[model samples]
Target: MPTKRDLLDLQFMDARCKLIDLAAFLDRIERHEGEPDFRLAAFREALPILLSEKPNRARAVLEALSDQTPEPIEAATIQGAFGAPQV
Candidate 1:
């Protein structure tokens, strides 16, 4: 059960980090709080799969988006994405 990080031969780092990236994006945008409801919904749905053991990250993301529902998110642990400074 290798984590995505172990697959160094493959080049899809951004894809691997979609859930995390989305989460941070959601957190950053919460202050404005005017994002489309579906974006929030997608984030809510995707969170569970993010924690699961899945060989295929794309599949988890797809499943999460396939049936997203509205849910409120409490504060997320925000961090700099991909080690780049926040704007």
Candidate 2:
């Protein structure tokens, strides 16, 4: 089993790069003039989960962005997912 230190040594750079990429994405979003986007809102809502000392942060974040309608829509709108609830 890998110790915490070993995990950090192996993954820290990759994690750091992703964090930087996310920050850059946020920067681009901030520079844009756009209407409110539910997907972006959901993404922001999930950010706090990363800071929490929870074992299931990935599951929590995925759930936060998921559509929880519990039933299928009668028809397809775009034949693809919006990546977050359309709310």
Candidate 3:
């Protein structure tokens, strides 16, 4: 059985993947002119999903951002600000 920590980690990873997909979609929008309006609207709809109330999702995004070779310290700072797990 997966421990609570493991479950949390997995949830975090899933959320991060969703965020990465959102970023790629945004990049596509930025790179292309005459993109459909619906595309932009869809991207906007996904924004809240990527930044949902779930802490694991946020943590996952932060983890992936921190893993970049350049290491975005801002992500780490945000994660740290959330503090440790509650009892």
User: Which candidate leads the pack in lDDT?
Assistant: 2
| Counted clashes in each candidate structure | 0, 0, 0
> What RMSD value applies to candidate 2?
0.9
lDDT of 1 at 52: 79
Candidates in order: C-alpha RMSD to true structure = 12.9, 0.9, 14.2
Ranking of all predicted structures according to lDDT, beginning with the best and ending with the worst: 2, 1, 3
Candidate 2: residue 49 Cα off by (Å): 0.4
Best-performing candidate as measured by TM-score:
2
Question: Candidate 1: how large is its RMSD?
Answer: 12.9
State the TM-score for model 2. Answer: 0.94
* Candidate 1: clashing pairs of residues: none
State the lDDT of candidate 1 residue by residue for 1-87, as single tens digits.
767677654657766687478768867877684545554566566677767786887677775555333553475466422221111
lDDT of 2 by residue, 26-67 (tens): 999999997868989999999999999989999998999999
Global Cα lDDT for candidate 3: 0.56
Candidates' lDDT values, in order?
A: 0.59, 0.93, 0.56
Spell out the clash pairs found in candidate 2.
none
Give candidate 1 regions above 4 Å deviation: 1-20, 67-87
Angstrom error of the Cα, residue 28, model 2: value is 0.4
TM-score of 1: 0.43
